[model samples]
Structure formats: structure tokens, C-alpha cells
Target: MLTPVTDIDGAPFWEYAAQGELRVQACADCGELRFPPRPCCPHCQSFASEWRRMSGQGRVWSYSVPHPPLLPEYAARAPYNVVVVELADAPRIRLVGNLVRAAGDPLDSLDPRGVRIGQRVRVVFDPATGLPQWVLERA
Candidate 1:
């Protein structure tokens, strides 16, 4: 299992995901939210922070379908779609994840050709990875 490295600052994120919730670190002082959790707030340099729950609704800000020569773990899913989802509540907060068919599905479960910029998506917890993945919302 190639799980994400859970560092001191980012461990809570994975914890939340394991609980089936999407959360991001927010500056306790300025209420500014940030991803890839850090010790200090980038907005106000506040050392105080807290995890805030997210709506889990976002749009595909961008996407990419990787070609060959990928890392060994990803090579098997070479043609999978990776998407940057811009959170609806906090547009500035974008998260990268694989767009899959459903919760706990494989990364390459969705067809690459089906992904599109600006497509609506919703978060889903992948129990296998203990992470938040995405699934396209029905129109």
C-alpha cells in the first residue's frame, strides 16, 4: 500500500479522511484555510490552527492524464485522471485527487475521456487508501 506520508502537520487530514470527513487546516486567528497542512499559517503567520470541515463539493479546476514512464506504483494506472478540485466554499483551497467512479474504487475506475474541466464533483472516502477521492456528480 503506497499511502501518503503522515507528517506532524498533515496527520490530522488523514485522520479526518479515515473518519469519512473532509477537513483542512484553518488559521485559528484569521480563519484562513490552507491545504498541505503546515505549522504556521501562510495568511497571517499564525501558529494557531484548527481543522475545519468542508462541504466536499467542488468543481474540476484542472485535470491531467499521465502517460507512460510514471512511477512504478502509478505505472499500472498510467492513464488515470488526476484532478484539481477547487472547493466551493473556499475557492482558494484546491485539492488533488483521482477522479473515480465511487467511494473506494480504483484510481483508474473512471474513463479518462469522461473527465472535463469545470465538471462538478463530490468527495468520497477511499477506505483502502484512507484518503478522500472524488466522483463526478450526476447532471
Candidate 2:
């Protein structure tokens, strides 16, 4: 269940992730960027869309360390950091991911206590999973 579930609308996002590129859908008709890759643009309701590349640099907008009784699949990785990152290229487009010491590192590898809001981070794709993970820019 941890694997991303892809549909026609979201397939491009996952496809880009697999290629180690961070991209978000944009309204082809109006040039408005959007996340969660949908068919219709929330800005203009246009069905035409395109995927725009992102800088993969962002600030830690928020984060949390979940307690027990979480999803059974993720319970073993307790005390992990789940962060919402506000993209430097698109402030309104935020992505959720883990803050790791390095690309491909385990979700809980970094101590949750070390994470904080407004910290600078860069995106790194997990070699095995291709999922986007965050790492402290200073580190």
C-alpha cells in the first residue's frame, strides 16, 4: 500500500519521478501549475495540461512524527518525518515526502527532532523506489 497508486491523471507525475525528475502538471491553456496532476485546471477549468519541471529545491513548510497505531505497513518505520515542502519555483505547489540524510536512505534514518519548519532542503530520488525524498541542503 505504500507504493503510489497511479491513474491516467497522475501517471505523468509518477513517470517523471521514476526518471528522477520533479514535475507538476500545468494548465496548457492558461499556463497555471498544479499538483496532484488532474485533467482539469482548477484555475481555468481547461482540460488541456502539460507537465512542468520543478527546481526540486524547497523549504520545509511543515512536518510531523506520527505515533503508533498508524498504518500497519508504516508502523515499523515509526517516528519518521513526513514533511510538506513549499517549492522554491512554485510557492503554492507543496510536495509531501520524508527528510533523509541522503538519497535512498530509510524514511526514519534522520532523527525527527532534527527537522524544523523553514529548513532548506533539496529533492533526491530513492534509487530503489524512485520516490522523492528531501535532504537538508546544508548537510
- Which lDDT tens digits does candidate 2 get at residues 28-103? 9999999878889999999999899998999999999997898888889898999999999999999999999999
TM-score of each: 0.94, 0.94
lDDT of 1 by residue, 76-110 (tens): 98799989999998899999999999998887899
* Model 1 poorest 10 in a row by lDDT: 1-10
lDDT of 2: 0.92
Q: Scored by CA lDDT, what does every candidate get?
A: 0.91, 0.92
